[model samples]
Target chain A: MSQGPVRKILLFVDGSEECITAAQYAVVLARTLGAELAALYVVNVSVLNELFKARIFIKMEQMDYEHDLEQDGRRYLNYISELGRAKGVSIETHIEKGVVNEVVVEKARILGADLLAMGELEPIKSRSDAFHDESELILRKAHCSVLVVKDADYIERLYQAME
Target chain B: MRISGLLSEKTISRLTRTDKQGVIEELLDLAMNSGQVHDREEALRAILAREALMSTGLEKGIAVPHAKTRAVSEITMALGVSEGGVDFHSADGKPSYIFFFLLAPENAAGPNVQVLAQIARLTHDRSFCEDLRKAESPAGMLAVINDAE
Candidate 1:
């Protein structure tokens, strides 16, 4: 049974290798569906805080890292836009600062996206890892239809065919 | 894009200027040497205008003074390290040590934003900042950036 037409798609990008494959697939899907695409990169503040708490990261001098992370997010979002451009699809880019999963879900809702796309996640090493896995959390929290793009080889072929 | 890729020893300098305006002009001259900027005066005016609106002096001894103008053909950047620290009217009221002078073509908004962000992220590292501060020469500064990248 079809849920409905997918007019808008929101893609979550993290600059991971897997996200590149996901981006290719997202571009292809958006092109095929004639859907408006928006790519978002969230600066995971919670992860930064976790590193700070664990002493893995030195104390932030004055929350300047947040601005840095925002810029980092823009860089990642720009990459997604490039991917979309290569496929002859136009993608709007957005950056947000927050817990990654929450931000992704909220953006999907706010965009009224019919579909949300993201990279394939790594295998959870343990139950705790699964519990904290951002992709898993996003899958649970997203109100729109979620698409996890795997099969990198096939997606690469699909993206290249668009050229 | 990586800031390291856009930077060269010729575009990196140990700034002798003690004031913000002098340091910015010094850096802009270095950027012009890269041959990416065609109109030096236009770029200077754009940067100063941006400064007039609000200081780009960020806290923690970092300042990125940037502008978009037709003067630059692409996203060009110059790195300056000031040992004496120049007052930029930063948010913390602290003098800024590292100066990233960026100029981009008016149309290249995407790469310009990405480059600015890359600079911010790299400078945010305390060790990176410390290493940059200690760089003795233009070549030394390039090496620090190379190692960081």
Candidate 2:
């Protein structure tokens, strides 16, 4: 029973439901294929830029906000690692401070990951829609195989059965 | 950004759904009816698609289900409190009682993430969650949020 050629899997999580779902998929894929799993959380410094430029949030508040975001990143990374552990999968976690798309792609390349798993791209209204710009960039530029995991419909069906 | 500014009296409700997908659909429908979301079907699809990727169930009985999509013209929010918690496949393996549904314009990552972070911060406070849970009505929920802010 050959498990394909996947050796290393990189998962990008951001505490979103989609990210969490992707993490689950990554864990299963890793366990089934006997691949090493690594999760990355980018702090999204771009948000800080806007927070500072707008001066909407005071400096102290901004500091507190940034700290909270970092804490969130760490928490999510830990959660994913714990998920991996519970599933008997060895998972490596990376918490970095940078732009989301670039950081993910760079880390995936550096780790020589064979697959990059993430959530589905948000729907665009027209040709100019830019909702999932980071995802778009990663999909186009990543060296490894990109998997956009979406399972809402399946989940809905499961819940409907319960109803 | 003030958390209260993102939420309104109309957006807060007592959730009746006991399942994750039902709760999400109910909240998104509320946002759509409020005219914040431009397209209900598209928004629902995008949010659900995002959910399939991950469970937004955070610890402390809170879940933040969010999506950035072309279905919304702006960042919109709907907060639903369920007395009977719904199973959300949380990392903590606990049911989620408080649900924050957020829909944002495809390009507005800044506000979208900011609101999600704000909701997460609020949920971290045990007292705040308690206050929210104890809220008698939508107005009560808004009051708790305003006081916390």
Candidate 3:
């Protein structure tokens, strides 16, 4: 009941180490199934920008700093994606403006992805899946299976299993 | 380094603040006073509201209080180590001692995925959590965290 051979995986990242860990795990899957990978970064809206702008002089100087941050985010995503790209994994990035949880689901649907790999929070989520906390939410909303990743060492496991 | 990262001082506080609400308020105040957040009350409300939707406490005595907003410019983080664990109403029912309060711009959602991924990596390490628990003060805790990074 799925299109093609489940060869496309969507990954959501937030410039955190867990995100890089999730990306590492995703590369293993992409390599195994020859799946394409897409990394997404969402900058959850800043309350500081709104309140400060409303009450005081909206400093272009400070706002410029914010713009630079967005660039840094893109660079971080690019660096992570480069790893997958080296492994012959088709990797791409998308930066959108919105909330984290909501946008995560939205991007998955739009990508027509077969699987979503997220870093898992163990002891609560399987030490192998990050979305263990919100798997139900993402699983219920997305038209795909969400595999929350636990750690990069699992990639060794994936490779060993493949061998 | 991004200014957000600087907010994570290499310090550990042997604070004894008990419970979730108390920690939340204390952390919010610290975040505000440090200028980590623009509106103290508003950010607190957002964190509380997010908690209502679901506890930010994932596991391993780690609770990440995060909110997606259109109010800030970039993704900012504030971390605290409470000697006593705080009840996060986690789905798995665990007390989280390490707290990471994250702030993102109103139009920032993609960063959340990356941020979560990074956190997972940090949390999977037993040594990291063990050291956090062993921290004597806030500066010490931050030092350990920064050293890990």
Write one digit per residue (lDDT tens) for candidate 2, span B1-149. 45677778888899998988899988987787568787888999988876776677767788878776799888888899999899988758999998888888865554565666566556778999999999999999999988877
TM-score (0 to 1) of chain B, per candidate?
0.97, 0.96, 0.82
Poorest stretch of ten by lDDT in candidate 3 chain B: B2-11
Q: Candidate 1 has which clashing residue pairs, if any?
A: none
lDDT of 1 by residue, B1-149 (tens): 45777889999988999988899899999998898899889999999987876678887998888777889788899999998899988868999999888887765543554566456557768999999999898888888887776
Every model's DockQ: 0.02, 0.04, 0.04
Q: CA lDDT, every prediction?
A: 0.80, 0.77, 0.64
CA shift at A128, candidate 3, in angstroms? Answer: 16
Residue B63 accuracy (lDDT) in model 1: 86
| lDDT, candidate 2, A53-128, per-residue tens | 4322335535655676678788889888877787787889998877778899999999989899998876643222
Per-residue lDDT of B1-149 in model 3, one digit per residue for the tens?
A: 22224455532244467888888776666565455466666777777776776677775677777665543466666667766677777646877787766766655544443454455556668898888778776677666666665
Better structure of 1 and 2 per TM-score: 1
User: What CA RMSD would you report for each candidate?
Assistant: 9.3, 17.6, 13.6
Each candidate's chain A: what TM-score? 0.88, 0.82, 0.70
